[model samples]
Target: MTSKEKIISFPHMGNYYIAIEFLIKHTLNMKILTPPPITKKTLELGSKYSPDFVCVPFKYNLGNYIEALEKGANFLVQAGGGCRFGYYGEIQEQILRDLGYDFEFISILNAEDMNPFSVYGIFKKLNQKLSFTKFTYYFALTLKIAEIIDKIEEYIRENIGFEVKEGSFEQLQKDFLNRLKTVKGFRDIDKIYKKYNILFRNIEINKPKNPIKVGVVGELYVVMEPFSNYFIEKELAKKGIQITRFITVTYLFKNHPKEKELIKFSGKYLKYAIGADGTDSVARTKQLAEAGYDGVIHVKPFGCTPEVNAMPMLQNISNDYKMPVLYFSFDSQTSETGIKTRLEAFYDMLLMKREKQKWKKVI
Candidate 1:
């Protein structure tokens, strides 16, 4: 550890930084050095330095670390798990070192299972004042806040497309996020969650009672990170499509262990786990198809092995169940215009299919 004050940093993942900043500021009494929001520059920087074949997340995170390092970050903390993500921190650390950037890299659960003591040990190393009691309190509060935020976002995804006023949901969501940054404790988080929940639920939307529901199933990072997927959910919502995404940090912690059931559901199509979220993707796609969703969108980073393996299985599921599935592979080179055009075509096809079915019923 350096004798000077440490500036800590981590890559951005949606609004996760809000909870993370709160935990660090309150528990460790340390100043957080957050990276700037991911942008085209971030992507360009990441792609410039990253291996051509590596996943897009590596490029994005590396870019984040470089930007933070430039901003005087002395310590970099990264949280990753499942498949290749387990090795990202070590690789990124080595890459930065090769580039002559001096920084301490801390990785949480890269390969090992989640253990509170291990995490506490990392914090203790960072700040001697940190203890299990304080860690537990702050960690629990962060978890609650994360869950609440995810739930709020779920509501936003459902209503954002059909908002009576174009930016009604977005404006309120911006206000909620701004308020979130100033929150200090559990009471503040809980109060804000409730306040925004009501506010979002009350926002006027012109959605049909039987709106087209689309299920999004795919690799976790690509699905969770909006910029990674080019904000596909928001784009869909803009087309008056309701999206159901079952993946969240809460689901990752609470239900990931019972993935045996997902495996069972997917076993007929996929005999083995392809690692990461492949099995879950197959099972969720089948579940959504059987549950009568109008369509399904499969998203993943280009060159991701697990999602690539799931593609054929998804095709089989789509054919067997007679469902429409749209696939998008994202990389730094993926053009927004291409994505928008594809999504427009997919939406029109789904709308036509729905109308044809309705006509059949009328006959």
Candidate 2:
């Protein structure tokens, strides 16, 4: 079939879809069928069709697939990972097939299969016209885009809460993403990032000498997908809470430490890799506690075993260092009100704790 006849779609994970879509359109030259931005209906559609015990990411993916298929997507893609996520494509494909959908599914996953060379192989099969040199150039550009996005966002999370003009940081970020949509080459992305880096730093802020800081660590999917976690970072930013989170598309691709490095970084709290992103969660929480952050927030889908395995280590690290830890488990039925209430209380407690520390130094 012609590239135009093969419309491709993948699930959304925050703004990273911009980068994913960039790579696909340039390499495969296929029609991109971006799923509708996720909403309550997407969650409901996914939940109704999903098995009772699967993780929430599975439900969300299933939902995205159904929506895309209904909208004339003949080609769908899902990424595989170390956890139950590795089986997502197989099961989700079967479920959609049984539902009477006609489509082809692809799992773009594997340690050996993610880099430009392997990815080029995957695309070459779909688009015979794709050349090695051209594919590599665009792939590199895509990674650069993802890296710049994460770096700017890290700055935004740290200062968006303190912007003198509300929404200035967010508006600039929106502008940057819009600019990214128009990028044609490496130089284009570099110029856009440099322009925005200065624009972001120029935005005024009223940050305190010692601001309340919190580190967020969690399951990979929930940590990256805002809708799944009910926009937790945005809600916290509203309280002027400077945030730090270690997981991003950038980190997964470029900075994810080796297993040995992660265990060593975790110190006495962990001796082995728990599973998937869980080990990274424990290690990062310890790093945050040692750095004297006010607290750490751990978010995961309900019944995620790897994260469940990391909790005991997290608690021990919390106790030994006297750092507070807030945990959140997400599912289709999770209560938004409860999340807000807990976050409010968590912010309050962090404020009180910071005050107590200040008083101790005074004496």
Candidate 3:
């Protein structure tokens, strides 16, 4: 609200804020307010204002916008476009207006059209002090940082389950992400990521050469946001299951080029994109089955039409390949205890199946 100070805010989606914060700071020199980490309170706020049947991501994001507005953020950013999210910005803006909040709502919904110059234009319009040359430099660095963070996270997912010391990998991940926030440029990013990658590798773990691997396939938001999925990955890891997921912050930067391969792989099941990550889900589940993974876990929000459409195809894949698949649809009202019990049953089944396979090979 102050004449000289402008605060821009966006919803939380894992550690993605770290790179976003670096970009806004180094390029536009604007103050950034991050919505609080998603919690039970956040879900409640979002659910109360949102349509009862909207996907879970909508409620969570609406809650984020409300809380950010309450905390004095004048500019709200909604950076999603795939699926119904493309239409959510205007709807959320209207809802907030109805509630009497006066502010600017910015949408970067057309992610495919985004480029360095377009991004520079957005910030330059907000503040004339943003230099095109400086923005270019920082933009490239910001992308590298995003990719590095994703890579480090993937490493952590693969190893965290078997750490010799409890919280060892987690503590390293925490330190690394916090340090990432203070890094000024590419050199700092490279140095910090390398140091942490080394530390993560050196951390003692008792992983079997071939471990139970579960590939997570779903709508990107539900798969990537821990709150939305009830921290399923952490629970699976605690049971010593290695996890693989294709969605990440960097997937946006790459424009999901892997989608071409996904189409080819899923052609027998689905010939065209069903929207969002539907095709990718089918393709990834098939890929995991072919690659000898123990199982596949599909996570999506309730009323997710694309994922719903893909479910039949996934069931076909499950039947043909004899690959075990677990499907989870989450909303604000989803019960944590129910999810925990179901996961336990699935893990037990997979363990027994593996043991049977081993016995058959020996016989």
Top lDDT prediction, candidate number: 2
| Cα shift from native, residue 346, model 2 (Å) | 0.7
On residues 1-363, what C-alpha lDDT tens digit does candidate 3 reach at each position?
Answer: 344567789988888888888887877656889888889989999999998878899899999988988998888888675787778888888999899887888876456547887777787887788778888898888889889999999998887999999999888888898999889878998899889889989999999999999999899889888888999999999999999998887875674756677789886887887878888899888888889888999999998998998899999999988889999999999999999999999999999999999999999
**Compared with the true structure, what per-residue lDDT tens digits does model 2 show for residues 166-234?**
889989999999999898998898899889999999999999988889999999989999999999999
Q: List the residue pairs that clash in candidate 3.
A: none
Worst 10 residues of 1 by lDDT: 109-118
lDDT of 1 at 345: 97
How many angstroms is residue 52 displaced in model 1 relative to the true structure, after the best TM-score fit? Answer: 0.7
Query: Model 1, residue 352: what's the lDDT?
Result: 96
**TM accuracy, model 3:** 0.96
As a whole number from 0 to 100, the lDDT of residue 228 in candidate 2 is: 98
Clashing pairs in 2: none
Q: Of the candidates numbered 2 and 3, which has the greater lDDT value?
A: 2
lDDT of 2: 0.91
Evaluate all candidate structures by whole-model CA lDDT and list the values in order: 0.86, 0.91, 0.87
Q: Write the per-residue lDDT of candidate 1 for residues 1-363, one digit (tens) a residue.
A: 543777888888888888888778876745689999999999999999898888888888989999998998988887676888778777888889999898788887553645567778888887888889989888888788788888998888877888888889888988998898887778998899889999999998888899999999998888988988999998898889999998888778755645577778885887777788888899899989989998899998898888999999999999998899999988899999999999999999999999999999999
| Runs off by more than 4 Å, candidate 2 | 1-4
